[model samples]
Target: MSLPNAVDYSIIICTYNPDRRLLERCLNAVSLLDTAGLVMEVILVDNNSSSALYTLDYVQFFLNAVPHSKLIVAREQGLSYARIAGIEASVGKYILFFDDDNEPDPEYVQVQKRLHAHYPHVAAWGPGNVNVDFIEGVDDKLAAYATEAFQDRHEVQIGYSNQRTWQGCYPFGTGLCIKREYFESYALLAAKGKFSLSDRKGNQLSSGGDVQMVLYCISTGAAAGVAPELKLTHIIPGKRTKIDYLKKLTYGTSVCYSTCLLEIFPDHLATIKSQMISERKFAFKVLKKYLMLFFDPRPKKALKLAAYIGAVAGDYIALNKPVPSGVLWVLKRLKAI
Candidate 1:
């Protein structure tokens, strides 16, 4: 599990039965990175995919084809466990939390290294732009919102900018860069048992692992930044653009967000309680949006509204329930939810 001590950056790509075609594209992009002077290594962590990865001739051949890249199996199935394995096995000062579907620019590694050198206190940083790959035939309205949401980020500027906190910024796991020092010291603690309130589990869209790690790093007084020069392409498949999946993702995201919010800011519970709005107001808003979008006769628009309402309901449910600790934790571990 040990790596050479001289590696400057370790790109850890975690996957669990990922789309073979898209995974190849992601690996191809990594292999093409312009690393003329920088010392980097790509470590692919397999999260116990059901289809025995090693048995696949193409997967083995692909790993061998990529320079300075190797495949390591993380027996655990969760993304957090795979990430923990990668972080422990890596020997680089800087770590990149890359997903199997993300493709980085040619100079992505170099740009991240330069930014790390400039802002040593910033624990985790991401690229300035994350362009989504929306294929044809996807819902046009959903694709538009997805694209807009991806591009709307102000945390890490291109050349020079101050570090931002969780208050205003959140970088997804794709192409996210973190300092190994901070992660080893503080962020790892948040990933303890069942990795509670963490990011996307195998089939569940529930995600907050990245945010949980970021919040932990922020608590340690480390700033989060963004680098515009380090561009990355997020491959969004057609299935993800569907209304059903979007609704599930949004609901899971809200649940994870609310859980992490309580974990990271337990002291703010009283403040949150005081600031809570009436249920009637929430219902009124939902009814208004439903009425406004229902008669529009646009199926996509109706689905979008349904997804939003479902997510809001998930958020309200999570906000009222306290953090999962005693009985709730047991229920979660048993998949009773």
Candidate 2:
């Protein structure tokens, strides 16, 4: 039951130094949202941007145009910190998180609210159809692997019971929605130092806070789901399509995978030790995988190899084991160690 006169939803957009055009597009889409009968508030979190975002003309316009909208600055420099700031300031029953580059369909909030009603057992959910719109065209090499950087979940239909079957079933943070109660619990855990994933500090692509949130929800006997009706466009800048950028993203994601595993499972170390392979064998595997990069040499293949090596390094750090010399050499060459 909702409290009397309480806001129904809090739309939180967390961003650092964002592109002006993209921010304008995002806010414009939000301003046009179909919010007829629902009580909603938009909270724009400036995550330590270099400039004063609240003073920007467009930002001021947005704040004045939308009822109950305001801009809050987060002194911290990470995405997770900005999100925490948003959570702390929100009073809505449900909280929605959107990136500055995300543009939702006009009916996104309504659709999300309807779906939540349909799946009351779910604690969190997001859009199933997340499409990418590139600001500029890419070369064939970069274009082939460009989509991998974004998400498209049109074919996925998941419920709480099977949320853990695959990572795809987990909701991406692009347009994630969570019950305020569950999010408050997560915030408490974070405050107590129990949850420590600070995702994407400034330009660094490190992630997994979204995954951690979903895992925590599931651990609390709740469910998560995705709905095709909840749609959004992830605007991608041309610079991010470069091979070097993709490689960095791959490495960051790989490390995040290992970090999240260790965070959620207390027995993770025991499990890894029990099934550990000899250092020599692991070194040989790394060498073999690296050699494949020389043969295929495609951007996609290179990224795949980077992800594998990153995962290995992440495991080494997480387990406090010495990285094999060969793996160490590879990581140094990739500038990821």
Model 1 TM-score, all chains together: 0.81
- The global C-alpha lDDT for each of the candidates, from Candidate 1 onward, is 0.67, 0.81
**Per-residue lDDT of candidate 1, residues 18-64 (tens digit):** 88767877888888888887778888888989886777776777677
Candidate 1 backbone clash number: 2
Estimate the TM-score of every prediction: 0.81, 0.92
Residues 76-195 of candidate 2 have per-residue lDDT tens digits of 888988998999998999999989999999999898778887888888888888888888867687775777667744745544443442355668788999999888988888879876
Model 2 clashes, total count: 0
Candidate 2: where is the Cα deviation over 4 Å? 1-4, 156-166, 335-337
Best by lDDT: 2
List runs of model 1 lying over 4 Å from the truth: 1-3, 149-156, 159-170, 191-195, 277-337
